[model samples]
Target: MKLRELAHSRTGDKGNTLNVSVICHDARHYEHLRREVTAERVKAFLGDVVRGAVERYELPCIGAFNFVLCEALGGGVTRSLALDAHGKSLSSALMDLDIAAPD
Candidate 1:
């Protein structure tokens, strides 16, 4: 299933860091996302989208995962040449994760 169908995302930009919170629609999909969405996958997905090194963490308390992508925002918005840094790039990149569909 599509990541959008499985979860909702909250994205943020702090200087060169792009912080993303992915909340799963259901707890059942947590393992699927956790197993499939690795740091490598996140890095590759965000390569063109964010432009940086990615660090992903799993949050058991929230049943969600957080991704802190460094140097992703192209240093800053003004320097990014009007790119829709958080909205366009981050979401598109996260969508590439091969998360399993809910059964």
Candidate 2:
């Protein structure tokens, strides 16, 4: 199953950093997402787009996970030449990540 089936995401950008938050539709599925979506996994999934470290912050209270991606914006909104420098589409792209169905 895709992550999108279980959660939705929001994105924010600061300079070359990108922040993505994944919030589960059902709180019960939080554990499953937590297990499947790791910083390493996210970095691998995003590939070359991310040039630095990936940090994962668990928000168990809200059944969410926040990922901080460094050097992902090509530079920064004002400095990047990329069309989607703000990385709004990044959250939507992340939703496509594949994960095992909740047990």
Highest-TM-score candidate:
2
**Cα RMSD (angstroms) for every candidate in the order listed:** 2.2, 0.5
- Badly placed stretches (over 4 Å) of model 2 are none
Candidate 2: worst-modelled 10 consecutive residues by lDDT: 87-96
- State TM-scores per candidate: 0.81, 0.98
Candidate 2 overall lDDT versus native = 0.95
The collision pairs in model 1 are: none
- Candidate 2 lDDT tens digits, 1-103: 9999999999999999999999999999999999999999999999999999999999999999999999999999999999999998888999999999999
Q: What TM-score does structure 2 among the candidates reach?
A: 0.98
Give the Cα-based TM-score of candidate 1 against the true structure.
0.81
lDDT of 2 at 69: 98
